[model samples]
Target: MPTSYVKRILDAQIYDLVVRTPIDEAPQLSLRLGNRVLLKREDLQPIFSFKLRGAYNKMLSLGKAELAKGVIAASAGNHAQGLAMAAQKIGAKATIVMPTTTPQIKVNAVKALGAKVILQGDSYDEASDYAQRLVIEKEMTYIHPFDDPEVIAGQGTIAMEILQQVPERLDAVFIAVGGGGLCAGMAAYIKTVRPEIKVIAVEAEDSACLDAAMKAGRRVRLKNVGIFADGTAVAQIGKETFRILKDTVDEVITVSVDEICASIKDTFDDTRSICEPAGALGLAGLKKYVGRTGAKEQTLLAVECGANINFDRLRYISERTEIGEKREAILAVTIPEEPGSFKAFCASLNKRNITEFNYRMGGASQAHIFVGVQVVSDDDRYNLVADLGDKGYPVVDMTDNEIAKLHIRHMVGGRAKEATDEMIFTFEFPERPGALMKFLTRLGDRWNISMFHYRNHGSADGKVLAGLQIPRKDRKKAHVFLDDLEYSWAEETENPAYQFFLS
Candidate 1:
């Protein structure tokens, strides 16, 4: 009864490198959603990710002569570590070409696995190119991060385990898609074994290669991809992966960074374990699906795919979780510059917890204050905003505003002195030694920095608010600097919060 892909999955040689991760029910998340949400604990694997299964299967499939030649791969992080560990198992040598900009934790992990590490370009694309060249030159066996038959077959084994583990009829299964390896494998197996179950794929909104491919009915490349969910960030889906995913995958949903942060929190509360954004992506998509469709009580399984989280990322996850979960509302209120107004605003809060309040007494007639307050639900946020507006208070809901969340919340002070022709931008300073220095070095010495504020959230990325003097004549230079910076950035020069306060 098994298809060729399912038969391949059954024959995969992976148990030597992978543990049979557990599938457990998420009681807390289930209670809240009025559905039984089951979690496949792939994060519990020895490498803290499911990549080991595919990596090992692929490497072991090579002939003794091929294995003697060594293995080479290009990965942002997880796949590199997985391949290195796989090589160690088979007594084969491996060379991993990784992005130089990868977090130190991931880079060190691969080195510890006895793989030769080569830090190459700023992205996976560049690193893969370098690896491809080396594959031909060294005659090494190239282990692709995804898109290989052995890797897909190996990943499909997870579906076999899931079928045996889940007792009830599963309504749906949500999986996070990167280069489409995991999703393609799981969907293929599930579609054959349990055709009744729905297979949904999740992706980071900024790097939705599969979503684009599905929309266009062919593989399409994205010019840019978001690195926030670094493990799942791929510019395009692989050719073979797209061929299978188009036919087998049911639906694909894309989630935002904030939503991913919230999903990480949800996993923590349910399992007391934190997952990286890409790891928590399936849960994020499941939540969105439930909310959007107003789904009733149903049996759902979300793959807890990987837990290779950089410890520093917790602060950013915690900070964004509140907004992502709709438990907190940020408001910019225009209060009169008169006394007793502050007390009045406090009184209007109606016993809710005040998470943040920033007021600097901007000027004579009026003062603007940025505030964050706890709320029970989305309706609570709407009601609070309405109440404030009814009281003749001009308010702007900063909850879903990108400019407000990233920049305004941090820039809660006065304007710089005579800072003319100043262009402001928010950037993520990656966590690594000399990274800040590298950023500064790239910024030419000609432009004067008018204002700078940085808040380290103890994560892989530090939030930085930069105001630079880019006069009309030098505006082109600023654009060039940003283009070459190789960092995630958002321009805030035209944000409402900037006009209300910093400007």
Candidate 2:
């Protein structure tokens, strides 16, 4: 059944342009997880991504007439560069339509390859629509990033290489899924050749089209997808890829942005190479799988698929790595507003490293302090919280609180007494030109914005924590207005972090 793909993968004429990436053993990760972990270093490809293999292979299939007509595609970044280079090598003009929010690095890389770059829309789906229209208007062939059979076959070559490189038995192979091409290709080949080897498909929790599809027993579209892992932030699985993945994939694992950050750190520790969020996704799932299954001494492989991340994003990724690895705990603790209360709280911490401390005077009786503590394990974090509570310091763990980690930790302060009837909401929207102003414009002047906090994480999405003074009588109407804004948001008025720090 899968021999067709195997044949195509073997015959893919990509070696001239695509490098055979090496597989490296991750000694640190293996020792830490108690499992033999291997990394397929696709990040070392000439384009610093595995995308070139597929793009070049697909271009090679084109006849001279089609090549003369030129080619077009929509990509967030990596695939655009790959296709641009492939088209240039084949002497075909290439046009790339990329999302406006795509990192400037990728935009420049594609332009450097002599491709016509058009920035349109804020998401991949929207840019794809524009690319399709251009393809029709310009009479150019559209090279799909992950949906085509040629593309899938090209990606399958990675699996074939992995099998050939690893002489030892592998219990499982973790593959990252965007529109499911890589997973579908690898899983089909793996199952066909070595049916006993498990194929685990990893996806970002916020962009888990495959997980959603698997649950529904059909492909499903997501209303919104987080773009931290922009390479994999696809809203839906591709039709052909899904057809193969539905049956071939043995399991699906969804990881959080923080977990992905932690995996990037882990990859760096072992490989000394930085990985983009999507590149580290498979490793994140492998870590999660090891944690859940506790299958010690087992051999596993994960694909590091890309390294096209913007340098500026490292700050945000570094900030979240500690928490992602369960090495840091953020908490809100209430102690007496007395002079020695600080010392007493410190004593209760059992000398654990304090990563952060944010404090502001509250009322005369109690003081709310935002503190970050280094921890060894989840149990250690729980014990620290218990110890604080036992010492009569009322504590609320903000470690898993999204608002706390994203916004509150940086802007913690006393309550806003004058900002009455304030409704706080956390929002995420595309990070593009005038996006913030556009959001504010849509919010309108009906209610005063009492509090606002925003930080750029160098991803395609921008996050905002806004507080608006909406009277109780008009809250339902205010909600209606927010819904009409069409941005992904959630009410944070009841969040404990907000209650302790900003309410």
lDDT of 2 by residue, 1-503 (tens): 66678888888888888999999999999999999999999999988999998899899999998988899999999999999999989899999999999999899999999999999998999999999999889899999999999989989999989888885799999999999888888887888888789999999999999999999999999988889999998999999999999888889999998999999999999999999999999999999999999889999999999999999899999999999999999999998999899998888888888999999887899999999999988899999899888878899998999899989998888477899989999888888778888988887899898999998888788899999999999999888888988898889899999999888
Per candidate, the number of residue pairs that clash is 2, 0
Tens-place lDDT digits, model 1, residues 1-503: 22678989998868866999998789999999989998999889877889998898898789999999999999988999889999998899999999876777788899999999998876788899999999999899999988998998888888999999985678999999989999989988999989889999999999999999999999999998777888988999998788888888889999999899999999999998888889999999999999988887899999999888778778777889999998999899999999899999889888888999988877899999999999978999999999989998999888988767776777787676689988988877655567677777876577888877765554445567788888898788777778778777778888777777788
Give the residue spans of candidate 2 off by over 4 A. Answer: none
Q: In order, what lDDT does every prediction score?
A: 0.87, 0.92
Q: What ranges in model 1 sit over 4 Å off?
A: 427-432, 455-463, 472-490
What TM-score quantifies how close candidate 1 is to the native fold? 0.95
Q: In lDDT terms, which candidate is top? A: 2
